[model samples]
Target: MNTPPHFGTDTPRDLVGIGIGPCNLSLAALAHPLAELDAVFYEQRPRFDWHPGLLIDGARIQVPFLADLVTLADPTSPWTFLNYLRTHHRLYPFYFAERFHMQRAEYDTYCRWVADQLPGLHFRHQVDAVRWNPEHDVFEVDHTQLDTHGEAEALGRTHTRNVVLGIGTEPYIPDALRPLVDAPGVPVVHAADYLTHRDTLLTAGHITVVGSGQSGAEVFLDLLRHRPTGHEQLHWIGRTDAFAPMEYSKLGLEHFTPDYTRYFHALPENTRDRLTTAQWQLHKGIDATTLAAIHDELYHRTLGGGWPDTVLTPGVRVRTAGRIATTKIELHLEHIQQNTRTRLTTDAVVLATGHRERSLDRILVGLDPYIRRDNSERPRVDEHFRLVLDPSVTATGCNIYLQNAERHTHGVGAPDLGLAAWRAATILNTLTGKETYPLPTRTAFTTFGLERPQPRVPAARQAAPTLTPLVDRR
Candidate 1:
């Protein structure tokens, strides 16, 4: 195996990555070979973790194992799921288990293992700000290092030719739940922190789970199954009519495939928006296992010959929730059909609401004047994933690329594991002026896989003309 190159303290690097999520993990793997170009990945966490809060012991990945960080884009790459299994000596046992998809914990372990093998990864480094330096045509990044006491007290700086920002999603709590975030002794928390307070909530007298997505349903089912027989009650409320299952058809799953992203990007703006709105159910829907778990809990309670303390109220919106005391919470809800409001008291309220993309406002403050925006107020990106800069800005062939930040322009595959490797290679190609990072080769008999590599077009067919008729006339 070839070792990655390193730079001296004074040597300038080619690029600096803001976060070390799976998106940039793929980039680090692909960019490893560019020895002349120095790169470093900064992560705020003390170690590698991908959605650690949601890595329930029995929870399986929504997508297949083959759709890992790099497999679909680079099957032969060492970072493939098969390679991960082989490296960990679990391939045979995994096959014997007869499971197509392993638990989310296992998947997360694989990612962390891969991250451990990679170099140039800096942890405990939280980027505080980024400023554009026009004179040097580079970005100046300011970061702080957390000390033993968890206080950020040390400051550092680095200059790079370009930067790739992949600061993942932020938990999205409803506006009404904002007050409860800092309330004293209020057992109100988002689903992302479920595991942190699972024991407390499970033992509570009455628990109400808000939202109807996968997280909400999972929390409700888990609580319903584990809570004491007659002491605890479980209540679920959502805007939808029961938890809807994700679309699992071959064609429906294609929305996260590269082909679908290409097709979606080629469509007109209005048509693309229409398609996205129409297909929200494909990705936003919950898992069937969660719904079935809820059903089983209900069936078990019915067989006991007594009414169980569990309620499922669909199409209801939470109007307000207040902490009545140190131990209880009051919720005001309005049902869609009843058109009348009602109130309920519960020991805990778990908001299983989803997440939204992190806003780029703070870090990109200096570059905001130069960055172009699309109709949705998101940054406009070029085909190479570079931010579309204003004409006034100039560079020494430097380009700021983005990963997991172009959901509107790139479609569903923007934040998915399927596209990570490809996006990284695209950025590499734009930077190196050559296709040096080739994807790994795979054999035909792989259980779950994409089609073989496609033929590359010749230079003439791929190149864009430098002098157009209008330019010549001018």
Candidate 2:
């Protein structure tokens, strides 16, 4: 990148965001109306697109429409999803349809609409590094401006009092199957790129899906519907004992509320680790509707008094994988309960194993000395979502905030869509040292722990006293 003179002025901004995914987009939308706070967000992508490869047809997001960009925190904001529909003249049609959950594609479109109109959002700009400048008492942000083709055009620098990182997660592939996917002319692929290879996969002789989550279920169902009835040759397997439905009960869903998140944050480190693994069904299970659809499709094929040529076993996992004569794939499987082993061959494989949070070591390398880490070497995040840095850094009133990177400290709600608005509001309130957005005292019906949970209500606004005119009575 061509290094040019500094692009920003001597006056530092209040906040600088590193990534423009849904989390940072929510923060930008909420920060827009606060005239007192000056903030800007940067995104590497040329435009906003949420999970473009996974936008399957007829697939709906897990959360309701109310969990939009700004509705849960500030419904009156112009960036709300309702406002988007109103401006596009689709409110009446949406109302007449009576749909609570929106399709995945529509949600992507809604985000793009907001990204197109929102100001102070610099797209095609990639933040390179962040460091503390004690001399100026501000964070130095170095970024590279990219052209439409993602080539570096120029290098610029900005100074900010605080920084927030919202870089999102990446697709995860198992180690045993990574070689198969990396090899050329192989049909093994992760579900994140399923749509791009759907036609090629559908033409294969037999297909195998290696996950039990919503994405895996959706992929299997989509492929099943396309194949012929009697000739359908498919296999679905995972590590779970059974295909379980997500915990969607009204009371069970309290786990995703701010109350539970706070309670979980205060627990012992070992206890928190155990709960995260035990609560897999909360966020990593199939939807009931999708499971029912799969069963219905299978039942329809049995009208001729013969079962469909398919196999679905839950307690099985691929122990090893390799190529079979370069024409098919071989998988060595094991049943966890029975301790039995077998081998299966398929023409193609779809791995819907899910995603892992992108590491922050590269960008935050400059701030390593000040960052306080836990036993696992992970950054310690406080309840306010600020990283617990050394006193030398905090003494200058410069803070480093986080979003969606606090799952270990905050709980599973760190990645939930329902908590995005609330978290953004909390971060803003903490940054400005005032209640920029008023949050609720309570959100869930159930109290999480025996110890009384603390109320998160913002401190009462300190209004100036009204003085009456001094009269003769004085």
Candidate 3:
């Protein structure tokens, strides 16, 4: 099999993607068809694996199978989920199953299948830094290749006209639980490592799950099912007012469309910040189906006798956590609405806290002087997802792009799987300075703001797409 040639060549590439997560994989897949464009992606890990720890049995992705790495951008591309099924000779079975959402494990396998076949993805290669090279009119990217054990085996450099940072989010641990997690006595673990610690957790006498998001619900449900019926001894508590269901109504789903993203970006900085928090239900709440499954399980356990020994409470926050002697743990909790406080003792704790977008400071510190920032000191990102760099860097015809790091600007859809392909296609079009993949003029049924949005054109009435001449605005 022919692979992309190693770096250190005389000619520079069009773009160098920093991380080979699903976001960058989508970009690479879309970029693959544009013959004039040259792109490569590097990942620190050995191969592609999405949320391996939270891939609980029987769980499925939130979106439909069509929300694959390439389908939303170019359904005709050979990398679509349907094509994967056909190639694997599972098309008939999948069709008969009639499942809209694909299983989590199956989706991981599909991604690995794509990652294995894509030529330019260099796994086990860690990107170290990025800097602007005015002399060469390109961006300098330094990377280190790692062996199986993740030790640096060799160092290399690549020059590219543009760089795309797809290094995704990291598991976030709140301050209150830091010491407990860091300490060795208790089996405190994040949901990101739930599968690895499942056995240890099950053996405990009592367990407590924190956070009210989908992960928390799933973890609590899984534990509830495994524990004996009467003596479940499980406590599920979170900071939310209620175990609210995610906003899954068709119109509410439109917030994830490109139209809403445009409107959100156009808002004032403060408004965008407020909306990110106010619109939490769109992305952070538990799925209705998962909630139903949990309720059903709890109802089943109550059919025989009184009730399961589980304490499910919301509107509570963990004030702090400490070890009780050597075998147990103590948690200081406060109810947000009732203004009440209490303490709970548990044998183990599972933190289902969500992730936060990883900071790009270490990798981008080299070019800090040239990058523009917002009033809050956050790096400013434009509608095209390019970092607002100083004119000096821009005039040199070099650029840096971002994925999954623009939630402050692009709204909640920044980390969404459904928008991955669309964003990738948008980036490619911006890079090529042409409509390489003709995107729809509009995507949502609702107008985001009062301002007149582009008319929703029907497929039959849409005109022939026009190509705009490339301008060297850099």
Prediction 3 TM-score vs. true? 0.94
Q: In lDDT terms, which candidate is top?
A: 3
Please provide, for model 1 over 75-168, each residue's C-alpha lDDT reduced to its tens digit, 9 standing for 90 to 100. Answer: 7778888898888798899889988777888888888887888888887788888877777677788877776566885777888878999888
Judging by TM-score against the true structure, name the best candidate.
Answer: 3
Return the TM-score for candidate 1, rounded to 2 decimals: 0.86
Computed on alpha carbons, the lDDT of every model, listed in order, comes to 0.78, 0.90, 0.92
For model 2, residues 1-474, the per-residue Cα lDDT tens digits are 122334777999899999988899999999988888888888888888798878988888988999898888888899889999999999999999899988889999998888888778888889999989888988999999999788999898999989999998989988888889888765988999999999999989999999989999999999999999998899999889998899999999999999999999999888988998999999999989889999999999999899998999998888999997888999999999999999999999999899999899989999999899998899999999999998888887789999998999999899988899999999999998898899988989998888677767555765567999978965
Candidate 3 ranges with C-alpha deviation above 4 Å: 1-5, 452-474
In model 2, the worst 10-residue window by lDDT is 1-10
User: TM-score of every model?
Assistant: 0.86, 0.92, 0.94
Q: After superposition, how far is residue 405 of candidate 2 from its true place, in Å?
A: 1.1
2 against 3, candidate with superior lDDT: 3
Q: Taking the tens digit of each residue's C-alpha lDDT, what string does model 3 give over 1-474?
A: 124337687799999999988899999888887889888888988889999998899888999999999999899998999999999999999999999999999999998888899888898889899988878788889999888899998888998999999999999899999999889887999999999999999999999999999999999999998999998999999999999999999999999999999999999999999999999999999888999999899999889979999999999999998998878999999999999999999999999989999999999999999999988899999999999999988876678999999999999999999999999999998888899989988999898779667879999999989999999998
Query: What overall lDDT, based on C-alpha atoms, would model 3 receive against the true structure?
Result: 0.92
